[model samples]
Target: MHQRNISTRLKRRRAGDPMREFDALPPELRRWLAEASLPWSPRSARRIWRQGLKTGGVDEALRRLESAEVATLKRDRLAQL
Candidate 1:
């Protein structure tokens, strides 16, 4: 369901082009994507890092990355259920 939500949101963005679509999302959602391990490429992580740098500078980007780790834990818990 979480995966589906991400996909659906992405589909509505930037002519179905994922990179542009991803770039279009807000920081919170981008952080969520960075943390979620659903068949993503290393480039996606790089993109999130770049987005972080662009919007809020290095510190904010790092903070977002840190928050992303928390999502991993949540995703794992959800998977277990």
Candidate 2:
């Protein structure tokens, strides 16, 4: 058997049906997700969306998603240094 490469993070640990979860998201959120910089789990994205909805609405949710993606990118770049 071939040796496996070391892992940097966890992968594919889904507890529920990811497709179903994704299908339940708002259409606008789904569109935004298509252009997102990172692989965002449906549950986490929904949590942020709900938070933004509470604070404002759909536009606010999109802003929150963008803000989150930018922050994650910055952290990833710093880790690579």
Candidate 3:
């Protein structure tokens, strides 16, 4: 497979059906994704979404996603150092 970027450590083979996973996302999350910096895989997003839902609720899940993005950015930044 083609490499997107070399420095970042986060990468995974996308599992399951992407279209169905994306379509199942709440509209708010889809909109949030529109503004996201990371190209979040559908499976990852859904996993986090469901995890957040289980732990708290939609708002909590959104917060978790934002946190995940920030953490990824930090990791990429460190990789560049």
Cα error, residue 44 of model 3, in Å, equals 0.1
Clashing pairs in 2: none
Q: Write the per-residue lDDT of candidate 2 for residues 1-81, one digit (tens) a residue.
A: 322222223243566887899999999988877667566778888999999999999989889988987786667667767
> Who is ahead in TM-score, 1 or 2?
2
TM-score of each: 0.44, 0.80, 0.75
lDDT of 1 by residue, 1-81 (tens): 344223211212123467776687667556655656353433555566677889897677666655664575466567667
| Candidates' C-alpha lDDT | 0.56, 0.76, 0.77
Q: With candidate 3 superimposed using the best TM-score fit, by how many Å does residue 35's alpha carbon deviate from the native?
A: 1.3
- Would you list the clashing residue pairs of candidate 3? none
Error of 1 at 20 (Å): 23
What's the true lDDT of residue 12 in model 3? Answer: 57
Tell me the lDDT of candidate 3.
Answer: 0.77
Give the Cα error of residue 3 in candidate 1, in Å.
25
